[model samples]
Every structure is written in structure tokens, then in C-alpha cells.
Target: MLNYSFPLTAAIVATFFAAGLVKGVTGMGLPTVAMGVLGSLLSPLAAAALLLVPSFVTNVWQLLAGPQFGMLIRRLWPMMLTIVLGTVFGSMLLTGGRTELTTVALGVALVIYATYTLLAKPLGVSPRWEPWLSPVIGLVTGLVTGATGVFVIPAVPYIQSLDLDQDDLVQALGLSFTVSTIALAIGLVWHGAAPVGNLLTSTLAVISALLGMAAGQVMRTWISPQLFRRLFLIFLLLLGLEMALHGLLRT
Candidate 1:
């Protein structure tokens, strides 16, 4: 069993709460924020383990809120299948104790994701190209998730490029994240990173996240969405830089 000191426990809860707040406001960022914060204090594999339940639960809530579930499944099944297969293959890095490499990959993924958020124009995909492009994005996103426990890089952007309307975009993102979370959990269990004993702490993390989400929803009306997003991207940029430096120096 993992022993938790009060400070460590507090830090973990605080991190998840903050992450959840971001997710509540932005419709995404929970795993990305949580993994970026927790990676500083824990191994990537351990962070991934703690993230499993909260990520799954929160995303399910998002997925259920949107309509056209059957259409999304039919449209995105190939990409979803590729994500699962890619995660299964890439999870070997985590299970093999390649901490430094995984850390570097996580940092790279974060930096790329953050940069795109800050600099990229809104992109749209041609219907003719989506069939080919989607599976490629899914595979890359899955590999990143397996190594780093972060799943919002290329995949989210790709989905956004499909030119979905506001509601469909939100639903598509939730669906992709849900699959990624489940795949990551299964990978961790297969690799022996998440044991049954960890469920207690995972449950606590879930509660913290939910509470934070509630608070954020209440605050959403008060804050400017544009400002919140800019600040959030800045945070990701700094965190990514820190992780990258640490990973490189350690390696």
C-alpha cells in the first residue's frame, strides 16, 4: 500500500481540484493539468494511476450531456479503435521503467499542445480527408497518453478541425477523452501500475474534482472565458517548460 503524508495528500487533492476547475470552465484540460502538476512530484506511471477514475467519471458526464451519441460512434469508430491499439502498444514504455523518456515525451506533448492553443488559427478539415487524417491523429494521441497520462494534444485539435458545431464539438471531445481514459486505465492495470488498493485514493481524487467543478461552474459566469483560456494556456506553457528541462537534465 502507498503511504501518504498529509502534505503530499493535500498537494494531490489541491492539484486535482484546480485541474477540475479548469475543466469545468473550458470543457477540457483535467488530465492535462493534473498530469502536468503531478508529474513534478510523482512518476508518470503513478500519476497515470491516480488519474484513471476521475478522468473516466468526469468525461462520462460530459459525454452524456450531448446528443447524437450513435452518430458520433459510427463516425469516429475507426479513430477510436486506432487509439486503443496504439495505447496498448505504446504502454510498454511506461511498464518498462523508461521514466526519463516518458517524462520527456510528456513535456514535448504539453509544449506542442500549448503552442497550438496559443498560436494556431481555427482549422477545418475537408470531409474527404477526415477518414485518413483521423486515424493518424488518434494513434499519435494514444501513444502520448500511454507514455504521459495526458491525452489532449493532436486528438483534440483534430476533432476541432472537423468543423463540428458548438454542441457536436463538445460531445466529440468528451467521447475521445472517455476512450482515452479507459484505454490508459487498462494499460496501467496490465502493466501492474494500478493496484486495487489505489482505488481509495482515486475515489478521493474524484470527489475533489467534482467539488472543484461545481465551484468553477458557479464562477464561470463571473470570469471572462477568453481571459481564462489565455491564462490557462500560459500555465501549460510554463509547466511544459519545467517538465522538459527536468526530463532533459535527468536524462
Candidate 2:
């Protein structure tokens, strides 16, 4: 569908598998990992298209797997709605010709979030602030997602501030990412960034991603998740830096 060569298609499949493996091991980072890798070669819009199915399917499972879905829905619905609104209003940045800008934006987003993850102390949000702050964060996160195809800046931190238990936290991420993915997919479709033929390719990528997740589950028994997560973040930081610098130089 993308008209890439055999080797490139193989590489994309491998990329998806690896991304899904990270999600299986870390319970997050599939889109982050995949977009950081794919964005270097493809337009952010194309990478976003390729990411839709795997991200949605996996996150849906993650969202449903936890015990607090109904409660989270009640609590986070406003943020979710705002993410959609922001995505629709901002999708033009992604679908337009400013490929380098989007790539740079994607790279910067990765660096900021990864650094925050590795260095930032845990933060808390007052319950009094959630009513107003959550929607604002969602709007910004959605705009960033619409412009750059990455969605883990204020959104992730906002979710963390809620101080959820480990299980609920994971499920919350799933819901957040699922909303982002669905909204992004709609934007892409609305602008013809994802053509009908691309669905076949995206669906195939889902298989590779699931297989990678299975492999990761097996590997999870052999090593420490904390170690893997640390290593993964460092890798992401470096990749983001390289991508950003490359974008800057090209401009």
C-alpha cells in the first residue's frame, strides 16, 4: 500500500514486532517506540497510519483487562472528549506538507517525555484542580498528537498525577492511548492520510505486533522489568535526540 520495497516492508514488520514487544514487557511505549523509529524514515502521518491497528487493539485489551474501567471512564471522560476535539482541530498540521516540522516536533516530544520519565520525581495533582486541568492537558496532548503523531507529554504526567494504583495506572494509560489512537485514525481518514489499501498493511502489522508481544511475555520471565524499562528509556532518549538533530539540520 505504501509502495515500499520488500526489505522496507520487512523492516516495518520487524519494527512493529519490536514495538509490541516493548509494550508487552513494559505495559506501554508501543506508539512511542514505533513512532520514534518509523518517523525517521516515513512522514509522521504515514507512521501514524501504520500504528493505528496495533495500538488500538492492544490498548483496548489493556483497557478492558483491568478492574477499574467503568470508574476511570466516569472520572476521565472529559479529558477523553477534549483529546478528540483537539485532534480534529489540529489534524491539518499532520496532513499538510510540513513534514520536517512534524518530524522535529515528534522528536522533541520523545526527548521531553523520556527525560521526564527518567528524571522527574513523582508529582501529585490536587483533586480540586482535576476538573479544569485535565481537559486542558487533554487538549494540549491532542494538539501535539495531531501535529506530531505522538501523545505522551502532558497526558502521561497528568495521568501519573492522579496517583492511581499500579494496575489502574496501566489501565488508564490504555484508555488514554486508545482514545488518542482512535481520534488520530479518524483524522487521518478524514484527510485521506490513510487510504483503504493501507488498512490491509496496518492489519498485517497487527499480527507482527502480537507475535512480538508474545515473545516479550516469554522474555519477561527471564529478566527484570525494571532493568528493561530503564534500558528502553535510555534508548528512546538517544533516538529522539538523533531524530531531532537530523530534522534541525535538514531545515
Please name the candidate that would achieve the greatest lDDT relative to the true structure. Answer: 2
Angstrom error of the Cα, residue 127, model 1: value is 0.4
Per-model TM-score, in order, reads: 0.97, 0.96
Residue runs of model 1 more than 4 Å from their true location after superposition: none
lDDT per residue as tens, model 2, 34-97: 8999898788788888888989998898899999999999999999999998987778898997
Model 2 lDDT, full chain set: 0.89
Best by TM-score: 1
Alpha-carbon lDDT, every model: 0.86, 0.89
Q: Flag regions of model 2 displaced more than 4 Å.
A: none
For model 1, the local distance difference test gives 0.86
Candidate 1, run of 10 with poorest lDDT = 195-204
Q: How many clashing residue pairs appear in each of the predictions shown?
A: 0, 0
The lowest-lDDT stretch of 10 consecutive residues in candidate 2 is 195-204
